[model samples]
Target: MHTRNVVSGVLLGIGVATFVDETVFHQLLHWHHFYDRSTTAMGLVSDGILHAASMVATVAALFLYADLRRRRAFAPRLWWGGLLAGAGGFQLYDGTVQHKVFRLHQIRYDVHLAPYDWAWNVVAVLLLAAGIVLLVRGRR
Candidate 1:
């Protein structure tokens, strides 16, 4: 039960952090998105992005895994897996269609880093798969 609180807090925290970093810092500080790519600090921004994502993943991964352990709750599933999965879904969608087909920079948190895009999609898929596994196990 205690683990549940900690886990939920973590998931929520990750969502908040994502909102902050993507919406606030990247947008305001480095001018990653709103401004032109040439104007943005492409190299520093991309490297920093990967670093932050790794950190978030490291902590959020545990929270999500723990949520899956618990039988049922919005906190466990929604905040934990659903949020991460949703974020991942975005990556997968962005990578598959947005990057190639649309050529949209809807959310230009990173520079034109294909490696970052690839990694994001891969991790996003893993998060969704892990969430499904947890959901399946919880049903048993």
Candidate 2:
């Protein structure tokens, strides 16, 4: 597969993961918002912005994928590796950078953040490791 396809797939995966996280945790479960200090209206606005960004990223990825397909430059192993890496990287960033550093929001309110952080990072590490392995294999 072409490098472009791999990159595009990774971007698509990241976009999908972001949307899923927003939908499931932010909207469905009402766990947290982009900015915890803000009002409900602000939170809703943040969500809308996040959704728009995700859509843009996903659309770009789709366009890249389509272009690569037209060129017949596609690699399944690389695509899968990229997907895993992107999803894991986004998850890690959200859990650490956004949640911990930026203090955007915890996994949930009235709960200790340690356990959630630990679980989230652990899973992210696993995903990253799997992606690395796939990437190595794909290079062979």
Q: Which candidate ranks first by TM-score, i.e. highest?
A: 2
lDDT (Cα, 0-100) at 38 in candidate 2: 81
Which portions of model 1 show Cα errors greater than 4 Å? 1-21, 28-79, 106-112
lDDT of 2 by residue, 88-111 (tens): 888889889998898887888998
Residue 130's lDDT in candidate 2: 82
lDDT of 1 by residue, 21-101 (tens): 455645466434422334346645653664477467646755655665665544444344444454555456545675556
Compared with the true structure, model 1 gives a TM-score of 0.44
Question: What local distance difference test score does each model get?
Answer: 0.52, 0.84
TM-score, per-candidate, Cα-based: 0.44, 0.93
Task: Supply the global lDDT for candidate 2.
Answer: 0.84
Give the Å shift of residue 26 in candidate 1.
3.4
Q: Cα lDDT for residue 46, model 1?
A: 58
The clash count for each model shown is 0, 2
